[model samples]
Target: MSRLRSLGVPAALFAAVVAVALLATLGPSAVERLAVTGLVNLILVIGLYVFVGNSGVWSFGHMSFALVGGYVAGLLALPTRLKGQLLPDAPALVRELTAPPFVAVLVGGSVAAVVAVAVAVPLARISGLSAGLATVSLLIACSVVAAQWQSVTRGQKGLSSIPTSTTLWTALGWVLVALVLAWGYQRSSFGVRLRASKSDEVAAAAAGISVPVQRGIAFVLSAFLTGVGGALFALQLGSINPDVFYLDATFLIITMLVLGGAGSLTGAVTGGVVVSVLAEVLRRVEGGSLFGMDVPARPGLADVVLGVVLVVMLLCRPSGLTGGRELRLTRRGTGRGDPTREPSGRLTPVGAAGGPGEDRS
Candidate 1:
């Protein structure tokens, strides 16, 4: 019952949002495309939330996981003829192989998880600013490798002709899956202990919780989900390049997490939706029009707006729009006194031997 109650509100909110997106898909193709992009962003943000939210660690390298997943999925899903033409010197296994879209996605996520484990071992020992810098280094290393590896990733030329199998509905389905996984993990005992460690490392260690192990677990899980999002991203576009997963994407995803309240699942979802919509509007504005009116295009205007919004949000409400609280329909106290009680009324502590007026002999 308790678990159900915990999951219910978020589930309902997710369903409502998905339903609206589905309806939007019934409109023109542009609208459908925008909706699909928003859904994909939602998955990516949720993936970031899984580790960053629970462990309170900032990772600039997660986009590398997405890059890995995208490449893996692209290699598996691209036609053999195309692969031979584009990647003649590729590994014999990759050059000859082909896989269904679903299998490709799974394999991509699995490989990303493996890489994450390898990365997390060293990362788990560090925290705060140093850990963040380590992740940035990882991102740089991955970018260099991707750019120099001509045989597999085609170097800077990018990979194309990947099968487009991700529809709007498919993207939405993945978003829901990511959301449930993130929400469930946050409510689990592992999540509780991890959060404790996040709050105070010494106290958590004293309580017998292995901080490194918990953080590693979160890191791996987050990598897997982010990889899945990457696979979907490749399929959605039917193409990818090493640069696609670099700094711009990293900043965009981190912005979503920070803007939405990095501590809660609801915040991640809200941030993704709000940012994505705002970005789309800004993009249109950059095109020099509002409802078909002639307006001058201001290059970089969207980014400026986004930056200002982020600064204001940080200064005004550091906790995010939700204020670090989940959206719940019911009002339930923490098993303390009745909140509705009058202030002048006598207050009795729990486990008391007798009521206030009844003295114990």
Candidate 2:
């Protein structure tokens, strides 16, 4: 029963994604396209959540991994004939290699995970403001590389001509995979220790939890997922530029996590759906009866509304829509903040004395 209860979170989330996909089929092509985009973004948000949610560390550079995955996957999936034209100066190996779309996506995620591992050791040692800033720097560095490496990335013109291989079902399949991984990690001993550290790093360390090690694991895992999201983004669009994976993508994804409640999987799903729908509505409003309706034209409107929403969320309810709590169909929190709290709230050392799932080791 306990194991089944834990599955409630992913089951509910999976069903919700399926419902959304079904609705997408009934809409116009544009709406269907938007649905796919939303699914991709949700995957990205979940990827970030794996690290930021559990580690309690904000990583602004997580999208860099996505950028890496997208490009690598795109390159691999591109027909060798197309590559010869798009990347005339490419190495013999890169120029000659091509793979099936699914294979390309897998490779994309693997490479992204490798990049994360490369940086995890040093990044693991930093925390708080420094870690966040370090990630931002990583983003900038990667964007610069992508823009200037004309021989491979095609410079500022972007990479294109890859097959559009990611259908709605393809993306949904990846979403389920990400959901399972995120939830499984959350329930694992690794995730427990990581959350323990997030609640209080000093105390977690004192309890023999290697804070850096846990952070590094989460970082690499999150990057792999993020990378896959990027690859899907690339496949869905059939093209990509360095700019696609930089700050703008970063902000939107982080907002999804924040709006949903970064501390829980349920929150991640909520934020992703809410933002996707809100953006779609706001988009129509901007293009339709907007300026006269006290709205400006073009893309800035969505950003402004998102910014306002973020501020409002922070001011009015900093913990997000779910308050960092998972869904509960069979019970409700009394809001008493007592020792008899929900089983999920018992990971902290302060609550360990008599709480459920307390770490006795």
Candidate 3:
């Protein structure tokens, strides 16, 4: 019974996700769309969590990668005639270039990684709010550029003709990729250094860790994953606009990280699923007429819910939903933490039930 309780949460989550996927595949409605959307968001949030959760820094512009990646993939996937019409003044280079879905997505993610490297070179020098603000500035600046770049992005009109190719199976594959990447990163020496910097930058520097470089690597890697997620999103939606990745989406992703607790990758992914379901439910309720007074749908209820959740999470369990502990289904003991203690307990590599170590990062 104790073992059952210990495994209950993970079991339930797996069952729920499996059930949703099965239903979406068999039954029809908006279930498939919603599942794909949730899965894509999950991928994006988990990617951001790789840096924000582990490094104790915030980045509001992770979505910028998504925007650029989506556009790049969309442009490449689009037919030459369609691209010419939508982006009439596009460069000959752009008009001449086109790729299949798989190749386009790869190029999109690579572009995002290159952009991240460019931004991280300078921005990684700073820490705390400065880093956060730098990323936010990047987000806003990208938003402006995406909104106004009519020749390439179609400005506010957005890009179309993207193929709807990201199905549940494809998204699940990406989810698996995210999990593996995050797990590998968390266990790597690089991840150790980044976490050390997150906990205490001065101490890490004193210990010979290059804080700037690690942070930059995290940024670039996180950007690549986010870009992949965005490319997948574009393939699923078959179109996209700059409005997709903005303050609203940014806040939601951040809220998922914070509410889930920055200490555990599992927590970040779980928070994404939880918040997505909550938002969907709220949207349905808000859109429908209840008893008599129609509860008109407000566009920002998800934000309001996330704000409340953040406050509650901070007050009740500052470490997050996972309390800094991960779900180790193959392990022999409980995978939770003591609430009274700090949430900085060392995490073992996935599939290796090891003990904690000294400050090694």
lDDT of 2 by residue, 123-143 (tens): 999998999999999999889
Q: For model 2, state the Cα shift of residue 323 in Å.
A: 0.3
Writing each residue's lDDT as its tens digit, candidate 3 over 1-361 gives: 3323333333544455566666666646576788898888888987897878667777878999998889888888888887777777999988879998878888988899999999998888887788888888999998999999988988888988777888888888777677667766766678777887877899999999999899898888899889988999999999999998888888878787777666777678778888877777777665665434577777766567768878988999987777766654333334355222122333333222331111221
- What local distance difference test score does each model get? 0.81, 0.85, 0.77
Tens-digit lDDT track of model 1 for 186-293: 666777778878878999999999999999999998998999999989998999988998998898888888898887777788899889888988988887666778
Worst 10 residues of 2 by lDDT: 348-357
List candidate 1 segments past 4 Å from native: 331-361
TM-scores of all models?
0.90, 0.90, 0.85
Quote model 3's TM-score. 0.85
The best-first sequence of candidates by lDDT reads: 2, 1, 3
RMSD of each: 6.9, 4.3, 5.7
